[model samples]
Target chain A: MSESFQRSAGRKVMSRSSAKELGAVSHLLVDAQQRQIAAVVIGRGKKAQLVEWAQLSGFGPDAVMVVDEGALQPPADDRERAAAEGRLELVGKRALSERGNELGKLDDVTFDADTGALEDLLIGDRRVHAGSLLGSGSYAAVLDESQEPSP
Target chain B: MRLLMTASQIRGLPVVTVQGGEDVAEVRDVIYSPEAGRLVGVTLNKRGFLAGRSREVLPAEAIHAVGQHAVMVLDESSLAAPEDAPDDVAHPAMERNVLGDDVLTEGGASLGKVADLVLLVGSSGEVVGYQIDKAGGGRGYIPLPAQLSVSGVALVVPNITEEFVQDDLVGLGAAVDEFRARLGLP
Candidate 1:
């Protein structure tokens, strides 16, 4: 089943070994080239922690389950650090066609809960296929111009 | 049909990079080369909620397309410092300003004065026509001739131009192709 990134935000992360809450989801780290979720960010800024997609044992409606506290780690690199800071958050960023026309702000992103593979990007009333996403940054998210969804 | 927009309307548009979709700057001024009948570059301003000028400029060669919402480039590296920008972009020539120049025919009959330039949308800064404040009243648009006899004071065009004066941009878009066809311009 597909899950929305917007809906997944704020869900608690629990450790299977300790059975204690580590933190809540702040946002998701996206791998633009692969069109998949790379990690789940917990908290923000200096307090931010990341749970890699590989570390998650289960992604449920109530909370995310990880092996233990060892699964929680600080941002691994500059890209992860930016994602932790919410600089690379996909939601709320303007969506632009490769030709430079504004489609709208990205409202939500649907991804396969089991695989972390992206499904669709919701822009206003339209649903653009994930394969159309070229890249994203601090300013806007670029999608293939020819992939514009019909109104 | 191709969409058309005036150069003045393009001011303040964000310069977005296609790779990361980052808006590096906003257009402060469109640098037009009157002799070449082409847009050479644009002076930029910092892009954000707060307004401020940027030191970088984007040359036309680096532009992928000029759309209604944004000016697209391949990436941030396409932007250059003022010193690296073309001479016309770095130091715009005052005499090259086409706005307010009289529009005259080969027969010396006055049509109007240039008010703004009409550009083809989705093109890499292609100027298609001129928006003029007609000699009699209101505004009109005229398709740009293949060759211009431009002077600081006046722009002399073919006498046939008088027949192609469009009342608005929508009409101008159609007129451009017809006019070009009539003049045998590709």
Candidate 2:
């Protein structure tokens, strides 16, 4: 089943071993080219933590299950740190076409619940396929304008 | 539709890095090469509180894309010190500015005074037209015609240019292709 980013926000993250809540879901960090969720950020700012998709034991509707509290890690690099800080969050970013025209603001993202593969980006009421994602930054998310390819 | 903007509008826009999504700097001035009809580089200002002119410059080649909201770069390292910048960028302060020069046709008819340059977005800073304060009335945009000469006093364009003056950037965008086709410019 596909899970919307809106539905996942604030979901509790629990440790499988102790079954204690580690943190709440902040947002998912995307690997644009791969069209997959790289990691899930929990909390925010300097105190933010991350759990790589590979480390997650299960992604349930109720809460995310990790192997243990040890699965949670501090941001590993500058890019990850920005993601953890919410500066690089995919939703709410202005979407610009590769040709530099503003499409709209991204409203939500849909991904596969089982594999964490990104499926689509919702820009207002428009659904953009995951394959069109080019790059994203603090200012805007760049997307391939799939409709009209310049000759 | 192609988005068009004046060079002056690009000033004060932030320069954001793609990987870390951090605003590294803001544009101070656009270093344009009117003779070449393209952007050469941009001087920068430091971002955030107490911000001021930055010593670093971003050469056009370092830019990933110039969008309406921000100028995108690969990373902060894409910026370079003035000494390491391209010749046009390093000494841009003294360059001859095109604004305020008279716009004249080859037939010697005075059209207007140059006001600004209109650039086509996403073509890597290609200058496509000129914004002018028309002699008899309001502002107008003209597709960049083949320049016969560019002197301190006047810019001489093809006589046929008078027929292509557009009312706005949107109109100028559509006129550019037709004007280029008429002039046999590739």
Candidate 3:
């Protein structure tokens, strides 16, 4: 099932080694091309760390399970990646069809927290599968014309 | 089954306790959990306009019903201060206000500031579209998508959103329906 990025934020990140809650999830670093979470960014700014998706065990309703807190590293190349990719962050971008139809702006994304796979786009206040994505960048997320909304 | 309600519609509804029918607070903000795919709780407002913020959050589990006139509560005591224990940190600051956030294109075209959030109501609540209050004296709704981004300054939308402006709320609602219809979902 898909869940919102908003809901996923603030869930505790639990370290199995100490069985202690390390910190809360702050935001996610989603790979736009890979369409999966690249890393989990947790805690406050500057002191924030990145737990690569591979190191995560599971996300319970209460906590995000990780085998080792060491798996989390200070975020590296986030700015480089953003700069290189033109920063294709998905939560607030406008969506359009290449054929010239104005669809809507993206409000939120629903992804499987377990698999880190993006599932649906809550675009234009509606639910469209990720399959509708044609192309995306920092400025706009183009969609398949068939996915365009109309009366 | 799906339920239809807007943030504006529920914003001021009275929240009363089920046991004695005592009024506690008014609905300030609806808190939704995407993980649970449901409306989890509401943030309450103090009785008067100039009152201070109440940290008390009403869990959706304690919500008796969301009625037309008022929001019924199971227990007023169930409305407790949000758990601020270090481990269970659900930050109050994490709550987003899309309203007034700038709407721009990847190409850097300014559409407008967000006037409202169009919520897609289900077992889980969704922020589906951003009702853009255009700078050019028009209005529109930008559908939410999987591939969007937010930041401290502005809400980045797909390019060329200004072209989709509708004149009024009714037009925006119709546009939202069209958006849903295209997706073949309820």
State the lDDT of candidate 3 residue by residue for A18-77, as single tens digits: 898888887666655566766777764567677888898886677888888788777577
lDDT of model 3 at position A121: 81
lDDT tens readout by residue for model 1, A1-151 = 7799999999999999999999999999888878988899999999999989999988888999988899899988887888888999999999988776788999999999989999999999889899999888888898887854332
Across residues B1-186, which tens digit of lDDT does each residue of candidate 3 receive?
122345677687666543323356788887643233345577888665656567777766666656434565544575767773221223433534456778888798888887765554321235556667776767666654433566635777655445546565455555655555554546
True contacts kept of 1: 0.71
The B-chain TM-score of model 3 reads 0.61
Q: What is the lDDT of residue B134 in candidate 1?
A: 98
The top-ranked prediction according to DockQ is 1
Interface RMSD of 3: 20.4
TM-score of each: 0.89, 0.90, 0.40
lDDT measured at residue A52 in model 1 versus the true structure, 0 to 100: 90
Sort every candidate by TM-score, greatest first.
Answer: 2, 1, 3
Comparison by lDDT, 1 against 3, better one: 1
